[model samples]
Target: MQEYADPVIDWLDGGRGYFAKKLYRESCALQPNGSYTKDLSLVEEDLSRVCFMDNSPVSYNWNKANALPIEGWTSDPNDEALLDALPILDSLRFTSDVRKVLGIRGF
Candidate 1:
């Protein structure tokens, strides 16, 4: 689970970084342990992060459009080759958001 959780954290942080830099569509990735049977709290936290709303450095989220230039690792770590891992993240993020907004409650 940590393997998945760690990557999710990195992706969230990266997406938040991009969003902060005003790179909207560029910021997206998948969450680990995301499913109909997963923990609701974790899922909510993950969604909030992708939406650029989470504030914790451990999490990640949107903040001020057009942030300053970054120094490293903007490229997708999951695949510096294909960049196809991002949409999975985006979909998971959106799913969590929809579930929360719709008051779907727990798994």
Candidate 2:
């Protein structure tokens, strides 16, 4: 049997277990009716910083692959796991509760 490391498991092991919160915060920040401006790049940069804070290698790989590090998982176009995660990925958006939990300055 071919062994494929589960991305989710790898992500958790990478010490970015709270990536979901980051993702939600970014989503909220980028929302049209949200507090922050609609600059996706700024949010992406922050998200990248979160990954870099956890593991340099993962951050390098993520940037090299030109993939968005969403919810601790690299959104690689060639990765089947990423493709499978797309559906539920949208559900990771930020809500008022999530903003409060993350202590996001802006709603």
Candidate 3:
């Protein structure tokens, strides 16, 4: 569980960080154990350090166009490679977001 903490925190602090917030709410619903509860709080703090909305003009234009930037998007290849090595993180983030939306409407 401790070994899972850092990856979870990083995923929560990534592009789809909002999924972490939704996961936290769901975990709280499950009545998790002490260690899991502690991890959640720590991840929450990490999430706080992440900026969800990009206020830049480029970001605004991209949002309006419903497209993502292809160039100069990633600054760290090593970090990108590291994330690529952990494939489950992407699934986890997506699943959490879907779960959150479904949970909201009692689906």
lDDT of 3 by residue, 28-105 (tens): 322333222212333345322222222223332312221211223244545453444244333434553323422333
Q: lDDT of each prediction vs. the true structure? A: 0.34, 0.34, 0.33
Superior candidate under TM-score, 1 versus 2: 1
lDDT of 1 by residue, 7-53 (tens): 64566576555333322222333346331122223333443443322
Residue 41 in model 2: lDDT: 39
List all candidate RMSDs to the true structure: 14.1, 15.1, 15.5
Give, for candidate 2, the lowest lDDT window spanning 10 residues: 48-57
Please rank every candidate by lDDT, starting with the best: 2, 1, 3
Q: What is the lDDT of candidate 3?
A: 0.33
Off by over 4 Å in 1: 15-36, 41-82, 88-107
> Per-residue lDDT tens digits of candidate 2, residues 1-107?
00222454455457855443332223323334333322323335543232221122233332332233333335455656454544433333533222232232221
Candidate 2 displacement at residue 12 in angstroms: 24
Clashing pairs in 1: 29-89, 30-89, 52-61, 52-62
Which model scores highest in TM-score?
A: 1
